[model samples]
Target: MMRFVFSLMIAVALSPNAAIAQDKPSKAKSWNLTGQVKARFDAKVVDMLCEVSGGAACADKCGGGTQQLGVVRKSDGRLFPVSKNGQPIFSGAMADLLPYCNKDVEVDGLLAGEGDIKIYQVQLIREQGTKKWNKTSGFTKAWRKQFPDAGKKGPWFRNDPRIAKQLAADGWLGLGKEADVAYAKDEVE
Candidate 1:
């Protein structure tokens, strides 16, 4: 019984680290593009500045933004998502990566390994005199104004439309998406 207890203790000690490593986020790398890259997709940065500048939608006319995506262009300047191989599998949270689409990008993310991500460093290529920081924020800022519940069961990240769009893209349709995935998992665990 003592030997079995010792083995169980060791397993418990090592398990957390293993679990952490698996859920770790991956990263990307940045490079200046003089020539054409084979794989370029429409993407953006989901940072707060972006939300203030671009809002929830694509920001087409009046909501013009600084964020742009890296496009794989030919000598004639025609663009494509397919690299030297096949089509690029667009990944990452859209709320986190889509606002910068159609703008020049410099990514610094990981290709493989446990916590891999393909993200942007110099994500935007603005045209001329644009201010660096956004003053008009706090729109999507989470507050307990709506749900004054006693439980820590208060909501989070609801007003932001980018996250909503991302959830929809990820096949999570409505309120039940967050409930079904996160809360349900905790119950099972």
Candidate 2:
């Protein structure tokens, strides 16, 4: 009986779920400000501004992936602005959706936000008639291609030389060197 009780306590202590529970709370619980919901639907990619203005040639005027892209759901014609992809901070889904401009696609991801300010975070996508799904990792891949010299680890913004140079010139807070010094002095005192 004593041996059985000791083994059970050891098993409980070494359990993966118990270890994870003690390490840290889930970030998803705090970051879910917009009530994110998993969504998988078929939609036609469109330029949000042009679609709103009734421009038939909207996709043609995406300005080389500079313009914002969105999707119009096939079932109800509900428009969803795709603001993010499966990448980390400062990333967008424009590149992932750019290739399928004006074409029908099946998107799987989370729909978040409220009322007129909703956004879609595209996790996976595929052509409407295709069986294979592709992960929405275009932004990070493009960034790696564009900045081959940047380090492989950490967020792209932190490793970007251009951003670092800009931050150095404008201070960490982007309020000029004088302000940064003033703020630091105030905080220290």
Candidate 3:
């Protein structure tokens, strides 16, 4: 179809090494490096996101800094972010947000008019293993009252499956749920 062919043609034109072509709105997922929007490059709030290869400082940042923020940029392209600042942009921890880099998310960031791109912050949405839910008015009723003030912070703390497993291993009648964790022992010699 003409649409497919046009898309392919735009893609080819957008490559860094590709020659200039007539101006066209870039495909959402693809960028054109020719003109206009390409000119938007080095312009306000828009830029070509590049992958960072490897280096010492880059290692520490992308590896685990785990911080996200909005930054200010200047005419010389110097950024004030605490990391490598004044230079490093789309790469390292920052580039991890690249559409290709993280496929799980739907990118909804922004391109401000001051030669800087703003990201809303990347988040890992999935957590595995058992997760606890609130209990209703059962034996747990009274527990909800003193839970916040308890040194344990809540019945849930003592009721962690890990904690229960350890207690049972130590010969206690370990209860699986928070409410049961407070059971009054009746067996004694």
Candidate 4:
């Protein structure tokens, strides 16, 4: 009885299920904000992650001119990642704030999940000392025009065409996994 109890305890302690819970990557099925709270404030457009870890210059290096934009609140300097559905509001945020980079923007939207704002609608976007609210659509159009080569290359061009070309030159069709093939021998199709 003593031997069995000790073995059981050891098994329980060593079980993978005994590990403490860890944060999983956000993979929300529904891309919609919950517990929505209406908020309106002015903040400067900044590159979300880089702005926090590195300074403005490091922020600039991300995504060429298309880094995911966030709002750094003027009052508290709290960085709110502008996102909807748990994902960074990629193109839409970029379209709205590309021209307004490092400039103040008046945001009105639903605040949700960690410091993300769900911008279902735009209230206004104005630079300091400017009464005129700039057009949001033109930011995307201008980006395409300016960086014609980099445009339409998907979110930040991490999957740039040049990389594929290089892979093709090396006689790779860009398929298959880097994992051990032997592990899949028992995986019945």
Candidate 5:
């Protein structure tokens, strides 16, 4: 009986859950891009300025997508500024993370950048303790809401009337028709 009890204790002590209970942060699992890695971790969304300054009014200062947002790893308190999302050009993760500002969430995405400049590209997120994962589609949703007349068949930039108007006014090279003609002539030569 004594030996059995000791063996059980040892087994429990060496278990993976024991390490989790101690609050050790999990490392990224696999490499996705040249400098990006797949990571899933619990973090608290925060306003970058407020979080770095140790300000207690982070929730109020987040500014509803106006101010920059980031996540602080719950296990290690490391702050990762979320700069992008799983979207094409001119898109950002701010809209996705803004609603959860100053709250805990589970994030699954790619971690990119190096040295002192780390960026978290949120691909999926859910409030802490929630079972349903929300896709990081806030940028597209917002764009559609703002530009209801924009067709949905192609890339957002190509479909955007504002960009189309600008391109038409400035020509393809944005340096007037003369420059565009000169560039085309040079290309043909």
Candidate 6:
């Protein structure tokens, strides 16, 4: 009985599972997209800023609408930034994820771009405990269905002059400059 107990204690001390069970939450976590690949992973939607900085108390308070949401991988605790069309800022991803903050979710998407600043162009998202997948963003879906041709020329460049004026004013049109994806990637992260 003494030998058995000592062996069990040594086993527990060296077990990887035991180590992981006591591991602290990941800090300084970041995602990289060195290759184009499709992946689906279970994660919790978290505010990247708060999750890495020990801001647990503020996690729920920072709504998806206010903070850029990222997926904290259930397996490894790494965070991957989500976006649409390589544009996270204006892609409506943030607002679409407002309902999923702090929830366990399955994300399906193509990881695009190179280096640490990559975009996971989310093709689908589904709550893990739920049965259905949300393939289309509700906000963009309604707009696309309502005006099929309005965005045929590109969503930012509409035929309506008033809409054009508003887009320009809002800096969505990019004005006299192009939104350089490479530049943006280097600038962020």
Ten residues in a row with the worst lDDT in model 4? 18-27
Q: What is the C-alpha RMSD of each candidate to the true structure, in Å?
A: 18.3, 13.4, 21.1, 13.5, 8.7, 10.9
How many angstroms is residue 140 displaced in model 6 relative to the true structure, after the best TM-score fit? 2.3
Residue range 28-147, candidate 5, lDDT tens digits: 344465456566888898899888888865556498777789888887678888877766566889878888988999887777764334577777888999998887878888878889
lDDT of 3 at 153: 43
TM-score of each: 0.21, 0.72, 0.18, 0.45, 0.69, 0.54
Q: What root-mean-square deviation over C-alphas does model 4 reach? A: 13.5
**Candidate number achieving the greatest TM-score relative to the actual structure:** 2
lDDT for model 6: 0.60
Alpha carbon lDDT of each predicted model: 0.33, 0.76, 0.28, 0.53, 0.76, 0.60
Which structure among the candidates has the greatest lDDT?
A: 5
State model 1's lDDT. 0.33
lDDT of 3: 0.28
- Give per-candidate clash totals: 19, 0, 3, 0, 0, 0
- Decreasing lDDT order of the candidates: 5, 2, 6, 4, 1, 3
Runs of candidate 4 with Cα error greater than 4 angstroms are 1-32, 56-64, 84-91, 114-123, 134-189
Q: Write the per-residue lDDT of candidate 1 for residues 42-143, one digit (tens) a residue.
A: 222233333444456444422332333223222223222211111122222232223344444333221221322222222222221443422112212222
lDDT of 4 by residue, 105-150 (tens): 6655445543332333333456767767543344445445655677
Question: lDDT tens string, model 3, 1-189?
Answer: 999999999998766421221122322222222231221111111122211221222322233223332222222343222111111122222333211222221211112222233222111111113233111112232333435444454455464455556876653544444434455433331
Candidate 4 versus the native: TM-score?
Answer: 0.45
> Where is model 5 poorest over a 10-residue stretch in terms of lDDT?
17-26
lDDT by residue for model 6 (27-132), tens: 2112344545565677788887788777854645455366777777687776677666223224447655667788888776665565434456665678988877
Model 6, residue pairs in steric clash:
none
Q: Candidates 4 and 5: which is better by TM-score?
A: 5
